[model samples]
Target: MRVGVLTGGGDCPGLNAVIRAVTKSLIGQGQCEVMGIEDGFQGLMEASPRVRELTWDQVSGILHRGGTILGTSNSANPLRDDATKALVSRNAKALGLDVLVVIGGDGTMSLAHGLADVGLHCVGVPKTIDNDIAHCERSFGFDTAVATVTDALHRIESTANSHHRVMIVETMGRHAGWIALEAGLAGGADIIVLPEIDYDIAAIALRCRERELRQRYTIICIGEGAKESGASLTVRERVEGSPDPVRLGGVAHVLRERLQPHLKSEVRATVLGHLQRGGDPTPFDRVLATRFGHRAAQLVLAREWGRMVTLQHGEIGSVALGDVANAQRTVPLDHELITTALDIGISLGR
Candidate 1:
């Protein structure tokens, strides 16, 4: 059977590894053809859709690389409506593919489900920086981002300590704070703030002062989506005809502004921005991506439709797509581990 594949939404480390694995495995069978779609659903919607042929050599030497050859766009999802769905359906048939493999986080996987509802045969592989894909212990690129953020925090630590100031470092995470939690803990951040818990800034400022009393410098790691309990800090900007509106960032600036007057202490903010996503894959991510890619190919060969490749309890496995899209996986603010951090007098900004 011939298979078609696409990587959608944000680009992550190990995407190339998955492509290489799929190509190598399919080629080994001697009876399968694997094709790639470009730029997510938008590529599939073009009038005369084009595809990249997967030859073994094309995928070689990319096992440890970051990003994908197929490219990605968070704004693209082709199965949203009749017109776009028809386009994708026509393109898939035109390419003569038997099944489709989609690698992405929630939005991309949800697009696969939508296409399936209209008679498209597909499977998914979860990919997200948030590490919030349900039933999956972890996803590819997460380790890499964690390492990146941790390193950044480490670099910022000495400066904050030397100056005896509060340093707020912002990392990526929309509705979950796994990145902030892991990186902050690893970087020895005095305070770690996440969206999972409603924040009390005044209490956090007090803790910062206490840290100052003891250590004289405070380093706080906060997720971009982190918000205080009373009001959201996002500033809505007008977009034309978007089905869902965009929620933009400013949390770091807002948090700094709020803390400045309360503490009367020197406060600074450093936004990591896209630096987290713009580097080489960490060793962990490289190995994990290779494994996920190789296993994804095996799953395709076995015809496990509607299952997403996932890492659970240190094992490579699969989970039903429905479970993946149901809701986000989040870290409990008062979890045993969280309490442990609290016991050590870490400020969670709550």
Candidate 2:
């Protein structure tokens, strides 16, 4: 069997671990030929076969590495574009792949489903910093993203306190607050903001001032899509057909400006951005990615194509690709846990 693999969407920690695990596991089966498809679906959009060889030595020393060995992309959806479809079909036939493994988030999985719908064999492994994958209990990069934010919050807290400033740390969670919520609570954020809650600039500023008066400093954790009441944070700033819609400046900047007046002194915003997705993945992510990789490969071996490896009830597992097609798992607006922010005197900007 000839297997082709690629990473898509934004880079994340544990990506290389997945690649390493998948390559090593598949290579052990002497009959299998493994190919690295560079730059997500774009690889298939480019090369005659859109695939290249993966020797054992090339996979070495990348277990603890970040990013991907085969590279990644934010473009190429055959189902969405005629050009992409032509490019992909041309490459797939030339490559002669029995199966293709796609590792990434919702957009990437959606692409995988498209290929499968077109009669291509494909398997998916969920990867998202947001941890918002539908039906999957967790995704590979979520743990690492949370830990990275927590660490940043820890460090930012001290600086904010010493300088008597309000530190607003913006994290990536386009439609969910998992990253902000978990990391905020873990790192003593006085207030945690989420896209699920409509925020009030005045309320957030007041919270910071209140914390400033009481503790001499304030730490605010805000999700990228978090908004002021009746207002949006990031607007679409890129091409419509693109999976990763370029975002305008995020809420952290606006909130930081609003918060400055309330602060007794200095105020700043730290956008975690790609830093949260880089470097050595936390142990949890490495383990999870390895588990997902192992399961994904097993699924391919079993001809369980079109099923995405999902995390269920704390276990690595699989789900039908169609189950997640066009679906988004967002933070529930009425979650009691979210309501608890009010109980603790942390405003949700309501």
Candidate 3:
């Protein structure tokens, strides 16, 4: 059997771990050849696709690596162009691929579903740092991203205390606020703002002022998608032809400006943009990626097409690609973490 592999969407930690596991598992079986697809689906559109035979030696010592060896792209959707879609199918046949193992977030999984509709066998492995894939308890890179954000928050807290200022740390989360919620609770942030709930500027400002009165600096954690009650603060305009064009950002800057009038201390915003996406994979992420990869390999051997590997209840499992594609799992309002944060007097800007 000849199997093709590619990574897509925003690059994340532990991607190399999944690739390593897939290549090593297939090679160990002694019955399959693994091909690496470069730059997501764009490789398939090339007249001479950019591909290289993957071997055990090539995958060794890559478990701790951050990015994907095969590379990735967020904007290459074959479905957008009929010629490109045909090229992808022809290229897969030219390479004699029996199946394609796609490791990516929601966007890539949706594309895999589309490819499968056109007679290409696809197996998906979830790989988002946001932990927002529907029906899955966790994804590979979420742990590493949370750890990075928590560490950054700790550092920001120290500086805010020393300077006697209100520091707002912005994190990435397009539709979900898992990163901000978990990191804020773990880092002991005084105010936590999430996209799931609209924030009240006056409440956040009052919290900052109260903390100032107690001779304490304030630390605020805000998700990039966080919005005011009636408006959204965006840093960039939507791209005309992009799939996800509504870029949610600049909320921290908006907060800093609005809260300044209510607080006597200095207010500043710090955007931790791509820092959460890069860096070495945490131990948990490495193990989880390996498990997901191995499960995908098993699915291939079992001829289970159009399925996505998922983590549920601390165990690796599989679900239908149709079920997961285009579905986002956002943070729930009545979650235990939210209650815990509220109990600890952490303002959620409500």
Q: Once superposed on the true structure, which residue ranges of model 3 sit more than 4 Å away at CA? A: 233-237
Q: For residues 1-350, could you state the per-residue lDDT of candidate 3 as single tens digits?
A: 99999998889999999999988888786468999999988888689998989999999999999988888888778777777788888889999999999999988889899997557899999999999998899998999999999999999988999999999999998879999999999888999999999999888888888898895799999999888899855655675444455667778898888888887899999999889999999999999999999999999988998999998888888999999988999999999999999998999998
What would the TM-scores of all predictions be?
A: 0.95, 0.93, 0.97
Sorted on lDDT, best first, the list reads 3, 2, 1
Flag the better candidate by lDDT, 1 or 3.
Answer: 3
Candidate 1 on 1-350: residue-level lDDT in tens? 88887888778877777778777877786457888888776678789886888778888888877788888777766755788778888888888877888888876777776777756777787777778878888888888889999999999989998998999999887777899999988888889998887789888899888877888888999988788888875543534332224655668878999898878569999988677776667777777776777777777788888778888889999887777764677887677658877888788887
Off by over 4 Å in 1: 233-245, 334-336
For candidate 3, the TM-score is 0.97
Order candidates by TM-score, high to low: 3, 1, 2
RMSD of each: 1.8, 2.1, 1.2
Question: Per-residue CA lDDT of candidate 2, range 169-253, in tens?
Answer: 9998788888898888777788898888878777877777777668888888999988777775676367666776666436788
Best by TM-score: 3
Candidate 1, run of 10 with poorest lDDT: 236-245
After TM-score superposition, what is the CA distance of residue 134 in candidate 1 from its true location, in Å?
0.9
Cα distance off (Å), candidate 3, residue 259: 1.4
